[model samples]
Target: MRVSVDTDRCCSSGQCVAAVPEVFDQDEDEGLVLLLDAEPPVQRQASVRLAAGICPGRAITIHEE
Candidate 1:
């Protein structure tokens, strides 16, 4: 799975970060979504999906490769 984040669409709600801190983060100054891992381990797929779903801004995109 590949994870991509559109920072421009991020609302900085931090839902993604809260859901999956290992995969996502927020810039302190801009409050934009920061993708820590574009390709996370298989074990982290669920959390990544959850984070993507919970993102109010729909900034997170997951692609299964």
Candidate 2:
């Protein structure tokens, strides 16, 4: 799976980071979403999907490429 995010739509809520620290993080100043790993390890798949689902703005997008 591949992960993508629209920065303009992100609110930096940190939900993604909280759910999947291995795949997501926040910027220091803007507190925006940042992908710590574009393609996270398999063990983190469920959390990554959960993060995408919990994003308030629907900014996170995932692809099975």
Candidate 3:
């Protein structure tokens, strides 16, 4: 699985970070979505997908390979 977040469309919402802290985080200055890991542990895939779904800005995208 791969994860990607569009910074341009992101609104600094912390939902992704809250849902998948292992794969997502916030920039100290902007508080936007910061991808900590693209290929996270297998245990985190569901949470990452959940985060993408809950993102109001629709900035999160997940790909399964």
Candidate 4:
């Protein structure tokens, strides 16, 4: 699984980080979504998909392999 985030579209809601802190984070300076793991471990795939789906700004994208 692959994950990416669009900071330009982020609303800084931190939903992604809350859903999957292992794969996402928030910038302290800007509070924008940060991709901690572009390619997270298999165990984290489910939460990653959840994060992408719940992102209020639609800033998260997932590529399944």
> How are the candidates ranked when ordered by lDDT, highest leading?
1, 4, 3, 2
Candidate closer to the true structure by lDDT (higher is better), 2 or 3 = 3
lDDT of 2: 0.89
**Can you tell me which runs of candidate 1 are displaced by over 4 Å?**
none
**Residue lDDT tens for model 1, 1-65:** 99998988999999998888999999999899999999999999999999999899999999999
2 or 4, which is superior by lDDT? Answer: 4
lDDT computed for candidate 4:
0.91
TM-score of 1: 0.96
Model 1: lDDT to the true structure: 0.93
Cα RMSD for candidates in order: 0.5, 0.8, 0.7, 0.7
Lowest summed lDDT window (length 10), candidate 2: 33-42
Each model's lDDT:
0.93, 0.89, 0.90, 0.91
Candidate 3 residue pairs that clash: none
Q: Per-residue lDDT tens digits of candidate 4, residues 1-65?
A: 87878999999999998998988999999999989899999899988988999998999989877
Spell out the clash pairs found in candidate 2.
none
lDDT, candidate 2, at 57: 81
Give the Å error, residue 41, model 2: 1.5
> Comparing candidate 2 with candidate 4, which one achieves the higher TM-score?
4
Displacement of the residue 1 alpha carbon in candidate 1, Å: 0.2
lDDT per residue (tens digit) for residues 1-65 in model 3: 98888999999879998998888899999898899999888988889889999999999988889
